[model samples]
Target: MDPVRNPYSPGAGRQPAALVGRDAPRSSWRVALERIERGRSSQPFVLYGLRGVGKTVLLSNFRRAAAERGWITAQVEAGAGKSLRESLGETLHAPLADLARPSAGRRLLIALRTALSFKASYDANGIWNFGLEAASAPGGGADTGVLETDLRKLVHDLAAAAEEEGVGLAILIDEAQDLAEEELVAICAIAHAAAQDEWRVLFAFAGLPSLPRVLAEAKSYAERFLYERIEELHGDAASEALTDPAASENVRWEPSAVKLIVEESAGYPYFLQQFGQDTWNAALEAAITYDDARVGAAAGRATLDNGFFRARWDRATPSEKNYLRAMADDGDAGSSSGTIAARLGRKPASFGPLRANLIAKGLVYAPEHGIVAFTVPGMAGFIARQPSTD
Candidate 1:
């Protein structure tokens, strides 16, 4: 065990040393992959949940497993500070290159040539070939439209080749909501094309709470075509993530502590991982046995004060902030859209967009019609600290 490690990482995008709370989901996720491999569930899948919910890490692990299973995998994160079309093109091309057979190098070059036109530039080899051009504007004779077409064609071809050669293709997109509506549609269209061609190209995406709705809005057939949900681990499953892995590492978690952590996390993998890490860190720090009190103390107030939590805080406009303050003072975690609007001194109708925005940011979760509450546990404590009268 690394004594200095602070396992409770709460950053915008942090990767784990080893995924501690993911063992349970693997079985069901494997079923999904097997279905994709057998060409049973070919539609894109959207995995979504509140921020810091470990959806991203699950997707990464699933992608690695898919690759190891002989599936060609392409990973694209939608919010990595790039245009969706550009990122999608690059993502599609990488897997085509990766899974290309040695004999298919010519086909890959031809596809690239057909997609991009380069200037005549000579390298040290003195092989006067066309220099690679911009993907969007391949200099010579290639059209931007052709790049799009060639990309789709290339993926379909790759999938077909993989199938013939006894492999599969998997495309995993995280933070998928950041993708432009048009690009999402285009990628789905490509997936549809692959399906028509009997090519096994599967997509798995993870994003904020609104992701499924976004996809549904983009394509009416999205709901019918995809398996979408926040990845969940049940009691036994959650126990496996904590106890089984620890046992392998020669570390042990008291059953009571594991049960408490599972209950607190609500089976959310990221929370489970965070709590386990914090408990471990806490135990190490105090040089004491890993007891509930010590672990809980180590987690302290910052357990949920994560990047996701801060993001919700940062999303509040001055008026929204005032509304939140009012709610906090009233001992309310959230308000009805109309009530929030009224408190903010705005017309109720104008609150629709703001409410949607808030929901998408994962600060609030809708429990029933017209009712919302903080998604993060114990957020009301932080809200109480804010000056409500401001």
Candidate 2:
């Protein structure tokens, strides 16, 4: 098979050739977009799942749906130590700038000019410009001196601009779990105010399982969020993910080969693409063979280990590596902290700060009392295969 014709995409956050088993949510979101256009309220969505369950991809798909409805949209990935105020300010610039604000032209111009001015104070390398002072912070700028208060004003202004332009604004945020509790509440405030004023704003965020609790704490209204929990694809959908793309390229996959690939992947979308790409490159016959799947599985192990797992591994200190190894030794999908502590030859109580740090890093999460699980799917197996040098 020619590699050029390989339709599967295996990169991080890359959209697959065929998005499978997500039709329900996609259709629901399309309806929500339409409702916003008609000045009707819709429950906003927050997508939650473990790593590799396609939250980012689904967010991307939803953004495209909003675009089709002629709505203004912005998608951003939240990162550690990054200010949501700064990110939203920067991302909202273009859409708000492009908005037809003729009625309120003077007021919006003053606000946006002040907002973009703040971005210039920081350089490409993140070096701050010391000894630089601005004449004034725009009264309506999102980057107000305070995060919460200013964010509300900023959001209100953008929604006003969008409503004036006869369009709705959609903000899709990825890695919402990275946001601090205070930041989440600030966003909830923005949403609450938007609804109260009947402004045209739609928000969707994708994050790990921990997102709901923080969001709920932010506002009681968050309880009504359209929570979509992404999980492994159904068996039929998983099979279609494997077979349909190949068939479109005029290549067929044997039943035996498809069965082998699906079984090995455990219906994970990213792993499916990993297997599909490697298997296609390994195949020689017109039809994919079971042997090709075996080879692909072998190839995928190294690809996942070196590319995916190693990135996290490289970031771990010696103690963190040993801590992870201990968890891997005691684990299936998850294990009790006490068990991991025993494996590390320490008392569980003493590991409290370390456990908290891991949670903050998005490496592991507490599913319930006393137990922790990897944020990423298949992470335990990858950790088990690592050399135990630490």
Candidate 3:
């Protein structure tokens, strides 16, 4: 096998050669885009799932599709900053500034300025005019610095500006579960106002399974936004993810070999790519075999250990590491806090801070009240292999 001809790319946020098992979300999203473009009220979107479930890939694909349709689009990550205002202002400035409709562009700019003013962390000059001869002043209504009150007006006015420019504005935000309560409310407010005014704008977010809870806490009308679960690929889709790319380049996967990798990967997109890449590298001929898959699976697991799981493992404090090891010993899915605490020789209540800290680090999450689980797929196996600290 030629490593140079390897078509499989397994990395963070890397798009699979063939995106599989996403017809439902993609079709629904196509309709949502059209609905927003036509000024028809449609639910905002939240694609919630586990980490590495391809939420970012799906969001990026949607943003790319919107851009292809000439929609004004901005993609930003949540939790990288204190507030979303600065990142959004920076994101929207480029697209809106180049719109060629000065009046409409100014409205967007004014909204941006209003948002930017609240982000004192953003230097005044950091928000550039993009060489456009501009005279837009910040509007009083949007510059109030009250997130709930002002964000609605800002996004509403931006949608109006988009309408004027004969385009629509859509933002794709990732890691939405990390958004502050006020930030989430401000976002919900924008959507609420958009629905009332029929604004030609959309906001789509991608986050972990707990995103619904976060959104529900932010606004009572959170159900107005449709949530899609991006689970792992399935039988046919999973097979295609492994076979199609290989077939494209004159490499053939043996049927049993394909089944082996797909079943081992549990239809997860990342694992599919990882196994495919490793299997391709391990095979001696054009045909990938079950024997090759077995070797490749071992190689891929080692790779994930040093890269995927190791990164998270390194981030844990010694006590946190022990906590994860205990949880890992319990099972693959989730463990009760009581069980993990018992493993660590402590009462459940005494481990509250540690559990919360692990969740905060994104290494673990509470699937239910008092139940903890690893955020990454196959993490429990990686943790279980570690020598116990206790």
Number of the top-ranking candidate, with TM-score as the measure:
3
lDDT of 3 by residue, 1-390 (tens): 999999898987898888878888888888888888877877689998887889999999889888888888889999996468767766766775566344445665555454445333344455544343433565435546676665666676667666766767788899999987778988887887787778988889999888887888789898878999888898899999999999988999999999999888898888889989999999999989999999998898888888988899999999999888888876668899998888878899999898889988999887778888888888988887877752
- The 0-to-1 C-alpha lDDT of every candidate, in the order given, reads 0.60, 0.78, 0.81
| Model 1 TM | 0.74
Tell me the spans in candidate 3 whose CA falls farther than 4 Å from its real position.
101-121, 130-133, 136-141
RMSD in angstroms between candidate 1 and the native structure over all alpha carbons: 5.8
Worst 10 residues of 3 by lDDT: 114-123
How do the residues 247-334 of candidate 2 rate in per-residue lDDT, one tens digit apiece?
8998999899999888988888888998899999999977999999999888987787888777877777788778888888655478
Better of 1 and 2 by TM-score: 2
Candidate 2: misplaced stretches above 4 Å? 100-143
Q: For model 3, what is the error of residue 268's alpha carbon versus the real structure, in angstroms, after optimal superposition?
A: 1.1
How far is 165's C-alpha from truth in model 1 (Å)? 4.3
In angstroms, give how far residue 375 of model 3 lies from its true place: 0.7
